[model samples]
Target: MSEGASFRTYFEVEGEDRSRLGAQVGEQRRRVAARLAEIRNVVAVMSGKGGVGKSYLTAALALGLARRLTRGVGVVDADLKSPTVARLLGAAGPLALSPEGVRPALGNENIRVISTDFLLADGRPLRWREPEHERFVWRGALEAGVLREFLADVAWGPLELLVIDLPPGADGVADVAELAPSLKGAVSVTLPTDESYQSVRRAMASAQDAGIRLLGVIENMSGYRCPSCGSTEPLFPGSAGSRLAEDFGVPLLAQVPFSAGAVEVPSGLLDRFLETLA
Candidate 1:
């Protein structure tokens, strides 16, 4: 009973069709490798829970990096079921695909964008009215399959950075690592609430357990300023970002204030954060 023969025999004994699926999986992995080879750096922008503006932060980072690089940057909306990269960046429809590979749409800042939104039946931007629960309903295997395709099939070309906006949780961590082994680490986002801090702590634990480096923490919507009184009020007072940084042994990158401005990227906060990265 050699190891190779035993492996095959075990699958046969279980009456599972292993060869066909194994070949497909192997090909998908190869495709992922080919695409990742062209990208220099990969970052998984993640959080413990939703509504912390993780996707927006990922977009801002991508745009900022694009502005500094001649080759531009790439962002894959890895939240397959609830993708918002296309809508957040206002990227248009009609994905360009050829024998070479699938082309990611260009955003306002010239950053290349890829999301499951482009793969919808009509290939149009996801509507705000549509409930996310209605769009994405799948188990872990299907979710991994979609992510694998995003990495393998998308024609990212040459990119300074490939910022992946992972969904809120640790389930997809393995898929991201397996698909893109060159991933540098994760940038965890959180709010100023106690709940957010706990969630972020769990996210950090997951990343560390997977051997992924913690780039730093970004505290978004930390405070707001009153126009009439000129008084600054902390939105989530006593933000745990600093404590998280200290406990996790990672830097506190930025505490971005909330703003209603229409700017795609907050220049001041983003600039400061980029400096730390340098």
Candidate 2:
């Protein structure tokens, strides 16, 4: 394997012998290590179910960390099919390959982002050019390979933190935990409801099963924010996030609304999470 060979290219190039494939695999692992070596912490934000604002919270966390830490922060949107972190963080367009590796786009607060969103055309869903019938057999494996490239190939600089927005499912959480051994922990995002947390619990359990620590629970859309009075009131019944945290023996780190006007950003939430990283 050449020094320039990357995980992304390993997927692109084909027809290599077994010995060469082994060296390429080793080289790709080295690339992943070199990329992660500069990153201080890796945290995966996940929800077992979708529509929980996981990506929004991921972008918020990435931007917030960049502001507070005064160091680089990067986000990897591992949600290949429906990636939105690029738009959420304002990382737009045409990513070119630098001599170092694939260059990540710049988002707000100078946050670096690598996502499949940029790879797709506008309004185009991720599609494999392979035969439809053959896809069922290899799709999962192919997606997993893409996830590897996202983790290993991008030229992410020295970052104080790297937040990964895992796709909505217990498997996505487990996949990331298995892929990145440097993972510090995982923060489960759930809505304030029994059903929501119940679904989210499977993801938390998956992370734990993969040997990743559970940082805490983030209760998104916990309440409605009164934009006029700047007050927060209950939108859902019961202390759902608290209950979820209790079940997992972890802290309920935050109860955020959907927007500030949508979900209130509580003061010191970022600060508290930072303490956990320390």
**Quick one: best TM-score, which candidate?**
2
What C-alpha root-mean-square deviation, in Å, does candidate 1 show against the real structure? 5.4
- Candidate lDDT values, in order: 0.77, 0.83
Expressed as tens digits, the lDDT of each residue in 1-278 for candidate 2 is 78987565655767766568778877866777778989999999988889988988888788777787876899999999999988888888688798987888998888899888998988999999888886778999899889889878888888899999988999787777667778899888999888887888887887788878889888888788777886888888766689888988987888886454322235567877887777
Model 1 ranges off by over 4 Å: 1-20, 121-138, 227-231, 264-278
Instruction: For each candidate, give its TM-score against the true structure.
Output: 0.83, 0.89
Name the weakest run of 10 consecutive residues (lDDT summed) in model 2.
258-267
lDDT of 1 at 161: 81
lDDT comparing candidate 2 with the true structure: 0.83
Candidate 1 per-residue C-alpha lDDT over 1-278 given as tens digits, one digit per residue, 9 for 90 to 100: 76665354554566545567777777778888888989878888888889988887887777767777787788889987678877777776689978878888988787788888776755465343434574555445566777887788888888878889998886566569877788888888889888889988987897788888888888888788566775768787667678788879987877767766543465465555555455
Off by over 4 Å in 2: 1-23, 260-265
